[model samples]
Target: MTNLSPSDKALVPFVSVDHMMQLVHSIGVEPILIGLADYIEADFKRWELFDKTPRIASHSSEGVIELMPTSDGEVYGFKYVNGHPKNTKEGLQTVTAFGLLADVANGYPVLLSEMTLLTALRTAATSALVAKYLAPKGSTTMAMIGNGAQSEFQSLAMKAIVGIDTVRLYDTDRAATRKAARNLAGMGLKVVECDSAEASMEGAQIITTCTADKQYATILTDNMIGSGVHINAIGGDCPGKTELAPAILERSDIFVEFPPQTRVEGEIQQMAEDHPVTELWQVMSGTAKGRTSADQITLFDSVGFAIEDFSALRYVRDHIKGTKFYHDLDLLADPDDPRDLFGMLKRATPA
Candidate 1:
């Protein structure tokens, strides 16, 4: 690799998985989460200026593959992600992703980065950012249902953004809860393990569900949730996959990222076509109401929108400018002359 010639060295910045972990550790995860939250909020506040649409999904019995894309007219970003719930049984992550950011002016990629970790980070940041507007004032405890890869990140993001310092973790698999609890230790948050989802909700004002099962599941029943709680439902992200009971959706004030997208992919998909729901961006823009009462139930039906991936890509592009965490990838062919394609290839060929 060291013998790479400068003549063939037109390179794009590439962030590998190892480098992403290094970047997170170097800048600190909470600070990055806060920074990403700021970017996401900024984008939401100016939600009218972007080209928005629902993500394109291709589904199968095993899982789903999706392409989430967005543009602010200056920069465009998209993430390629897959969800295979059965992958865990074979010793692999249930979800994995990669993303790219490009300059709209030149139509050339500026950065390509591994988005598996970034997705988890931005998802947690999005939840916490929404909770800042929807959660009850002085909320300090969160019930982390479905303790898996996202549980620790969600717990930390809430602590950083909404001032929650205690997280009660629960999972159908006890080992997942133990894993979450272990990862959360020394992160300045008190972590608790519970035997069931209902037990985890004890004394918690915020409940986050992040299971990876690709089916209709009642992680929380109507009777399990009470008044004055904010629910961050992160599991039910595709059609035929939902985490809350229909009765719970009926009573809560639901909020979503995009109506057209959420109607088909989010928890709101379980409701009627006319079932009322508010867009979170409207709340951020002060055009609609958020948490109006301390006793009101608030639900953030997050389906992992494209704008978040855009924002996360932008954040990485900005912070990684001077860092050594990225490598140069020769992904594009650079010809000596724009029109002399034959000559450029002939020159590169060994005689």
Candidate 2:
């Protein structure tokens, strides 16, 4: 017996890209990442609180599209994103995304925002957070493979979060690497353009792959990686896309965000069903170890999780409280009389 009428319920606000950027800039990237990491960890620790499911995907000849949905009893969220590798050639982004946040109690959307830029930010932040735990202590140099739209954020996040001051870069397309290097030019990071992946990884403590390939390709071979190197696998985040040689994962201590999802999408998908890999939450919660020895090879298989997007939406909504750029969207409708639903639609039009 609830007395409140459905029409009396409050509407959820919608946030836009301008609002999202303003919020991120206001909160600062480093602080936002720190907060997101904490939120992700807390959510993972209470795994039972969420109704989680693997992302829904629609594959096409060009690329694949995915919808990731999750809920934590009170709030519900989902992201709509597509991966089209040929996009860059057509001057379009390889990925375009938007997401929605809703109230689980009523299944009404509260916020909607573009997730393209936010995805890049959150992915890089997740990489750095994982590296902070798994990489060798005091590691200051990193090798970045596959410099693309994600490259700049990866460079900045590692610099701001993990003290990485130098980035050795390489890509099949040299211009992409140069573009990334140019973007980092006065950002206090020393950029070294290299001829190959091996050259890029030389003497580096962390290696991050952010390539946009849509198929299984070996960007890193076991021979190129030396001892004590942490690999942040960012791209190759789908079923057929893989960056590491199968053997590379075999030689490393692997970690992932969500095992059920990552098993089908992460770089470690090449491994067998029973292959041992630690979930990052375990390390964050002290239930498992991150880097036991400086010489151990560590790999963080990041396939991007729904929780990250949830964290980003929370950040945007909390920070864009008074912004006028975002307006109310009529995604749901309620009538004062349950039997007057058709009348409500007719009433919406002027007579």
Best by lDDT: 1
Top TM-score model:
1
Model 2 worst lDDT window (10 residues): 1-10
- Please give the CA lDDT of all the candidate structures: 0.92, 0.83
Tens-digit lDDT string for candidate 2 (218-283): 898888888888999899799899999988888899998888999999887888988999988788
lDDT of 1 at 98: 99
Score residue 50 of candidate 1 by CA lDDT.
86
TM-score (C-alpha, index-matched) for candidate 1 = 0.97
- Model 1, runs deviating above 4 Å: 1-10
lDDT of 1 by residue, 121-201 (tens): 999999999999999999999999998889889999999999998999999999999998888899999999999888999
In candidate 2, position 245 carries an lDDT of 92
Q: How many residue pairs clash in each candidate?
A: 0, 0
Clashes of 1: 0
